[model samples]
Each structure stands twice: as C-alpha cells, then as structure tokens.
Target chain A: GESVGLHLPTLSVQEGDNSIINCAYSNSASDYFIWYKQESGKGPQFIIDIRSNMDKRQGQRVTVLLNKTVKHLSLQIAATQPGDSAVYFCAERFNNAGNMLTFGGGTRLMVKP
Target chain B: GAGVSQSPSNKVTEKGKDVELRCDPISGHTALYWYRQRLGQGLEFLIYFQGNSAPDKSGLPSDRFSAERTGESVSTLTIQRTQQEDSAVYLCASSNRVGGNQPQHFGDGTRLSIL
Candidate 1:
C-alpha cells in the first residue's frame, strides 16, 4: 500500500542548465533514502543518499534534499551533461525493513546538447 | 577493486523451462541482494542475504522463485516453471555491511526473456 512515487515521467534539460527530479513517499517510517541512475543496458548506479534526520546532502555536482514533513525528496544536478541522461529513481528504506529498499517509478532525464 | 558481477548477460527461454541466475558480489562484502525490473519500471526487491543470517525472502513473488547464497560468496536465483510474466532484468547488488546506511553497489543485470 505504501509506496514511493515520482511527479514527472520525463524531464528535458539543456546541457548547461540545472536539473531537478522530485519524488514523494507515503511511508512515514522510512529512515534512509537513496538516488540511483540507470543508463540503457546497465544496472542502476548509486548517485547520492540522505538520512531522514538530514535535510540535504551534496555530492559532486549533485544534491539530495529531503522534506520529512511533506514526505518529499528531490535530486538536483548542476550543469547537466550528456552523460547525465538516464532514468533516475528514488528509493526509501524503512527502519524495520532490514535494508530492503522501496523504489519509486523512475524519471527519465534527457539532457539536450 | 571489481564491482558486482552477474553471469549470462542475456537469457532467452521458452515457457515452462527453468532458469538459474548467478551473482558474484564484490570481494569481502557481507550483504547481497536480488531485484527484478520489468520494462520501463523501477526495481522490485526479491531477496537479501546478510552474513550467516537466514535470508529475507519476503519480496519473492511466488513459490516458483527462490534464491540461495553461500556464506558471503556467490549467490544464485532459480525460477522453476517460468512463465511469460517472469521475463525481466534480474539485478544483483552487494554492500559492505548490513546497515541501511551502507551504499549498495550493483552490477549490470541479466536480461531474461520468456517466450
């Protein structure tokens, strides 16, 4: 019944522009969240992750923001590049689930040159 | 260091045939996982193995699907009497430890086609 979902199915962005992907999760017991990038014919690659206690975390040119009050999560990528084009997914881990991750329907990120 | 490795990058078989998928986790990683991804969909958790603990198989879709892990080494997933709905990409991942905070590294999945 509880699930993670994305607001958009596809996002088109210019090479030099920033991109943002949004996710909404219904489970309030989830404590950990992760973002992954899946390219064609490849497995989902780890991007960044954030814990429920923290609101934001930053990586190389990428940031993950979490809002527990709204049960929302977002991934921000700066200076989108061709390599950044992929299907992005947000996953949540419940405290009692023992490392099991609940994944959201992916958002296809298309970076236009 | 090598990342997670899976065998038979692609597999095609007729309905009613059984299939076995293999996964080799990163050396020294203690936790392993299996997931399924249908066309244009996010991954669905299948099973998990951590150390000597009994595997968590709650995500398995049915009794026809099963998996086994040897200690902390390679793991195998078996599907018996496969059906068309079983067609999907089987993904494997491993993490350094058992905590939820640990990041799981994944390998290119095996694409299974049931005809």
Candidate 2:
C-alpha cells in the first residue's frame, strides 16, 4: 500500500532559527501537497502547500518544496518560535477525487527558547 | 463565523463501547473530511464528503467506521465496538471548494481513549 512518511521523527532547533521538516510519499500521481502543524490536543493547522507542477511555494514565514522525481517534499519554517513547536505533517491530494489529502507521519519540531 | 468546531473534546470508553464524533465545518464550505491520528503515527484518512456528490470512504480501515454529512453543514463519524487500538484523536477538516490554494481549516479534534 502507498504511504506518506517522514525522514525524521523529531527535530530540535533554537528559537529564531530556521527549521526544516522532510517528507517522502509513495504516490506520484498526487497533484497537490500541503503542510500542517498540530499542537498538543489540537487539530492540524494548515501551513503552506505547493502543486506538483511547481517546485517551491512560500506563504507567510513558511515555504514548501516538492520534488516529483524523488517523490519527496519538505517544509521550511523561518524564525522558529515556541508556538511553532509542534508536530508537522505533509499531505498529498488530487482534484479529481473527493479531495481528501493523504498525510505523512508527523515530525515533532521542538523549539528551545 | 467559527473556523471549525467539534464536540466532546475528549472521550473515554470501554473496549466494547461505541463512539460518535461530530464536526461542524465553516459556514458555506462544501468539503468535509475525517481522519484519525494515533500516537507517533500519521493521519489516517477515514472518509471525505464533497458537496452533493457521493462520499469517498476508500480510506476507511474497516467496517466498524462510518460517516455521514447533512446537506453541506454538519458531519458525524461513528465507530462501533471500538477496540483498544481504536483509541486516538479524530480530526475533522473542511475546505472552501476543493481548490489548491484554499486551506483546509481544522477543528481542535476529539481525543478518544479506550480502556
């Protein structure tokens, strides 16, 4: 079965520093990818997303990079904050279907103040 | 309007008990989704509802899980005779219209703990 996965289970970074979270997906047919952040006991909050056609996209202080060849994706967060210390997940989607996004195993991001 | 809302922020039940999770998507949003997140695991897609079209339950893990949406408003997910492994946080999300840029607003989620 196809699955979306993360390269690392956890990442620790100093506050105000940059943080990068990586994800690898098995399905190449997915057209869209999204990054979400989840705090303790809270639902996932959308961060940023990029389509398959584009290699990179940025929003606010976050950027999403997609590599179709390697079926890999990454999220870059600028100026990590204590509030940003949470689990980050990457999701894949297609427009034709019901638009449900497949999620990757989350990577826990810890920001030390 | 609220972004998205879910009921019963937490639930604890016996292994043989059933559970129901509710979600109220943002006003006028036409898409709804249900997902489960276990500890140290990724989100598992359970069901998807988009407007008037037939829902997609392809991601449902077993027959114990079922969901339904009324018109374009609220949605409910039911789990029958849940086992201990069924315990997890159930998250709900809604998107404007199934677009690339529109973000899928998520609710706080319902944490289910099976004893």
Candidate 3:
C-alpha cells in the first residue's frame, strides 16, 4: 500500500546545532505536505508545510524541502533547542481527496544541552 | 483567541465498556478530523468532516467506532465494546475551509487506556 515513511526513528543533536529529519512518501498524487511537532502528552502541532507547486518553504527557524522526483521531504531546524525536542512527523495530502492526511512514523528528536 | 478543546484529557476503562470522546474545533473552521495514535506509531486517520458534506469514514478501523459532528462545531467519537487494542491517544483537529493547504490546528488529545 502507498504510505509515508521516515528514514530514522530517532535523532540526537547537541544544542545550537542544526537538525535535519528525512521522510519518503510513495503517493505520487499527494500535492500537499506538512511537518508537525508533538511534545509528550500533547497533540501534533503544525510546524511547516509545502505544496507541490513549491519545492521549499520556510518558517521561523524551520524549513521544509520537497523533492517530487525522489518522493522525498526533509525538515530542517536551526540552532536546535530543548523546546524543539519532540517527535516530528511528516504528513502528505492528496489533492483529489477532501483534505485527508497520510502520516509517517515519527522521528524523535533529542537535544543535548 | 482559543484553540481546539477536548474533554477529559485521560480516560481509563475496562474491556467491554464503551467510551465517548468530545472535540470542540476552532470557531469558524469548517473542517474537522479525528485520528488515533498508538504507542510508537503515526497518526491513523479515522474520520473527517467538511461542512455539510458526507464524512469520509474510510479510515475507521471497525464498526465499533463511530463519530458525529454537529454542523461545524463540536464533534464526538464513540467507541462501543472497547477492547485492549483500542487503547491509544485520540486526536482531533480542525482547519479553515481552504483544505489541506492550510495547517490544521490540533487540540491536546484524549488518552484512552483499556484494561
């Protein structure tokens, strides 16, 4: 079945360093993608999103890069902080459908102070 | 000024008992969604509602699960004869009518524990 997946289940980084998390999706028809940060005991919080029309989008200190050719997406966080430590998930949405998201297994980000 | 709100942040029940979860979406948002997340997994789409259109329930795992949304406001998810496998965090989100292109605002989910 078509699905979205992440390359790593866990990523450890030192404070002040850059963090990059990768995802691979198999749905070619998906036109929208989003990155969400979920802290413990909380819901998934929207971080950034990108549409098929654009290859990259940036927000605050986060950037989302999309590669349709490779069916890949990446989220980059600059100067990682303890607050940034959480489970990050990448989700894809097929335009043909009425705004439904297919989510990928999360990547847990751990920042060492 | 408020975000989505959910009732009873945590629920614990024995097998065979039924449970109902509630969600209050952002005011004026017309799209609402329900998702389930098990331990160490991703969000599993359960159902979605957009305005007065028929809800898409294809993601529902079984007939035991059901949900209802009144107009564009509060929504409820009911699970009947709950089993241990039903233990998970139930999440609810809502977005502006613009669809997936717009980020969905999520509420802190309800944690369900079935023993």
Candidate 4:
C-alpha cells in the first residue's frame, strides 16, 4: 500500500535555531507535496508546497526540500519561534488520485526558549 | 475574502446517535474535502467533491458514513449510529480547482465527541 510517513514523532529545538523535519513517502508516482502546520485546537495551516519537478521551494521563513530519488521530503524552519511549536505534516498527491491528499503521521515540533 | 467555514465548532453526542457536520467552502472554490484528525495523529482523508462529478467516497470508513454536497457550495458529512471511535476533529478544505498541484485551504474543524 502507498503511504507517507515521518522520520520523527517529536523534534525539540531551541528558540532562534533552525528546525528540520523529515518525511518518507512510498509512492513514487506522487507528483505534488505540501507541508502543513497544525497548532493545538486548530486546523492544519498550509506552510509550503513543492512539485516533483522542483527540488526546493521557499516561503517567508520556511522551506521545503524534495528528494525524489529517496522519496523523501523535509521542512526547514529558520529562526524557530515559540509560535512555531506545533505538529507538522507532509502530504502527497498523485496525478491520478483525483486531487485527494495523502498525509503522513505528523512530527510534533517543540520550541524551547 | 473569507476562508472555509464549518458550523458548530464542537459537537458532543451520545453513542449511536447520528450527527451531521457541515462545511461551507470558500466562494468560487470548485473543490471540497473532508478529513478526520484523531488526537495526536495525522489527518485521515474522508471524502471529496469536485464540481458536479460524483464525490469520491473511497476514504469513507464505513457505510454508516455518508456525505452530500449541493453543487459546489456546501457539503455535509453524516455519521449514523456514531461510536466512541468516531470521536475526532472533522476538517473541511477547499481549493480553487481540482488538480494535484492546487493547494487547499482548510477550516478549523468541528470537534465531534461520541460519549
């Protein structure tokens, strides 16, 4: 079965430091990927997205790197803040999957001041 | 420019009762999706509606779960004879169009608790 999964269940980072979260997906056919942040008691907020054609994509303070060869994806947050503490999820969508996103187990990011 | 909206931010009902969760997608969005988030877990895909096409219910857990959409505007997810395991946050999302590359915007979700 095709699945998306995270490399870590929890990642603790120091404030002002950079944080890296990793994900591994089994479906090589997946062409589009997205990273989302979910705060407590809130919905998953879109952070950034990348296409299989692109190896990296950058947002305001976040970046998503895709390694198609290893079926791996990672989200990097610069200057991690307390507000950045939340669960991060990676989702993949294949061209024939009818626009539905397949999400991986989330990685909980904890920022320490 | 309003985002996706879900009603009754929270709902608590007894086991075996039927509950309907509503989703009001963004204006002009042609795609709608429903997902379930268990405590300390990832989001589980439930169902989705794209334009007038038949909805994709493959993600529905069981026959007890069903969803309806009136055109592309509003969608309702109904769970009959809800069980304790059905407790979770039901999230709604919508995108401008139907395609793998289009990013979907989400709502806060309706927390359903089956007591």
Candidate 2's C-alpha runs over 4 A off are A1-8, B99-101
For candidate 2, lDDT tens digit of each residue in B5-112? 998888889998889999999999999999887776888888889899889899899999999999999999999999999988888999998755566889988888
How much TM-score does chain B earn in each model?
Answer: 0.98, 0.95, 0.97, 0.98
Cα lDDT for residue A69, model 1? 95
lDDT of 4 at B3: 95
Best by lDDT: 1
Interface RMSD of each: 5.2, 5.0, 5.3, 5.3
Give lDDT per model, in order: 0.92, 0.86, 0.91, 0.90
Residue pairs in candidate 2 whose N, alpha carbon or C atoms collide under 3 angstroms: none
| Tens-digit per-residue lDDT, B2-113, candidate 3 | 9999987989999999999999999999999999988778999999999999999999999999999999999999999999999988999999974647888899888898
Clashes of 2: 0
Lowest summed lDDT over 10 consecutive residues: which window, candidate 1 chain B? B96-105
Shift in Å, residue B16, candidate 4: 1.0
DockQ for each of the predicted structures, in order? 0.46, 0.44, 0.47, 0.46
Q: What fraction of the correct interface contacts does each predicted structure contain?
A: 0.62, 0.60, 0.66, 0.64
lDDT of 1 by residue, B43-97 (tens): 8999999999999999999999999999999999999999999998999999988
| Model 4, position B70: C-alpha lDDT score | 97
TM-score of model 2 relative to the true fold?
0.91
Candidate 4 per-residue lDDT, tens place, B1-115, comes to 9999998799999999999999999999999999998777788999999999988999999999999999989999999999999998899999988874889899999999999
